[model samples]
Target: MPSATHPSPPDKSRAGPEHDLTAAFPTMDLETPSAIPTSGQCLDHLKLLEAFHVLREDVATTDGLYGIHDRFVDDVYPSKGLDEKEAQLLFRLREKRWAIFVANAERRYTIWFQNLPSDRGRMPGQLALAEMSGYFEKTSGIAFDSGINPPLDILMVWHAHLLNPHDFLEDCIRYDKKLL
Candidate 1:
């Protein structure tokens, strides 16, 4: 695996203009609930804690969001001719084998980082998109068509702190719920 400062190897199958990834973005349905958090409805720390306390008392399963993803993913939303920065992110995903949020027109998948060590104490680990061959697709909650490969549009890059005002979260990256 490459270091965070480096990019991954050259591979057309990973991501590029040849991929034609325009049809991979899936929209979220507001009526149903999912384990993943969506967009447009995030709260600050105080509101999060208050909501958590309230939900703790009730049996209502409040599947909310910690934070939203940044705009980098949006820049490459079409996933055509992925630039250096975009390719670098994909290389990180490939190297780390992080369970990223891959989307097609129909569904989303959570590709997990199977090689990560479990003994990180209280610190959270990163999920990266490195190589396409290493994707753990079965755990991602979607069944893809034979020739279909989605774009790695959103990644919920987790952090280990909860000190944000807009998001009562350790951290969030590429966490747009609308793109789920």
Candidate 2:
């Protein structure tokens, strides 16, 4: 979830008559106002990811980016819940966000394997695990920031380590108490 201090992105898809599209994109010429694409007309993957990145940075804990679509909608419409039309729009937005995240993760996973030496042995995986541990130790006291990403190999190892919660916790406690 985004921190209370950070303002939520406007729901431009449902913007009223008073909403000014030109103001949002100052550089663009809006002589023909219809040229301005609404969120429904076209999905901007990069823009959406950038917005998600901002929201991710505001989150203070691990796994904070998970289920962000739901959190964002709930946060924006706290008093009056979404109507049927709004619900459909939100569903589309959530689907796009999920697709973008999965695609990026897949790309990173592929790149991680491509960068590895052809040796294809236990040593490479072990080294990644070790490196992941070191990364955790080095960044133990730092606040969570989505912008600071680990190398894909170390990230893969970290993901695997997280699957075994007990062992991961025990290792963190033993090696870097602050990580816990």
Candidate 3:
């Protein structure tokens, strides 16, 4: 059979899988975002996730969730600090007195997230198991979804605060407390 395709010179470029675009990019490695499963410890994070979820529903009702999409799974409820947009969001969250809120919020959230089971392998994680077994919301198995995103968001916010803990802590100073 006559080969219609022009063959490249050996000196010019290598042939076979090495030269083929498909072969050259056979497998693409991508960073998969995991759900940050947790047994709720930070009330603010829980509330915020619910707000974000509600925001999603509202926005979708207005339009149709076109640009925005949910995180990987329920485990990692809120995928935080994974991008520039999110950084901007956190930046907004820490505006003026709000920084104090995020400072305290993130500190508590990060502490809780860090304390979560480090491993999520064959066995279900501590948070997930607790949820399924109705340990969290014991009211007829109506547990709060301790999403991955919220804590992930906390991780980002907390780390940002950690970058300058003293400054943030100082910023968190309430003059009312000193008056007492």
TM-scores for every predicted model? 0.17, 0.27, 0.23
Residue lDDT tens for model 1, 83-158: 6666566544342222222122113233322212223322123543333223435544333332223323212121
- The C-alpha RMSD in Å for every predicted model, in order, reads 22.2, 18.1, 21.1
Q: What is the number of residue pairs that collide in model 1? A: 17
C-alpha RMSD in Å of predicted model 1 compared with the true structure: 22.2
Residues 1-180, candidate 3: write the lDDT tens digits.
101131111132333554342332223322344375333324444544544444333332231123222332222435533454443332332232233434555654544444343333322224453443354347223333454433333445644555796765553342111111
* Clash count in backbone of candidate 3: 14
- Candidate 2 residue-wise lDDT, 73-112, digit = tens: 5666665646554555455555555455555555644433
* Model 3, runs deviating above 4 Å: 1-95, 120-144, 151-155, 158-180
Better of 2 and 3 by TM-score: 2
Cα deviation of 113 in candidate 3 (Å)? 2.4
* Candidate with maximal lDDT: 2
Candidate with more favorable, higher lDDT: 1 or 2: 2
How much lDDT does each candidate structure score?
A: 0.33, 0.44, 0.37
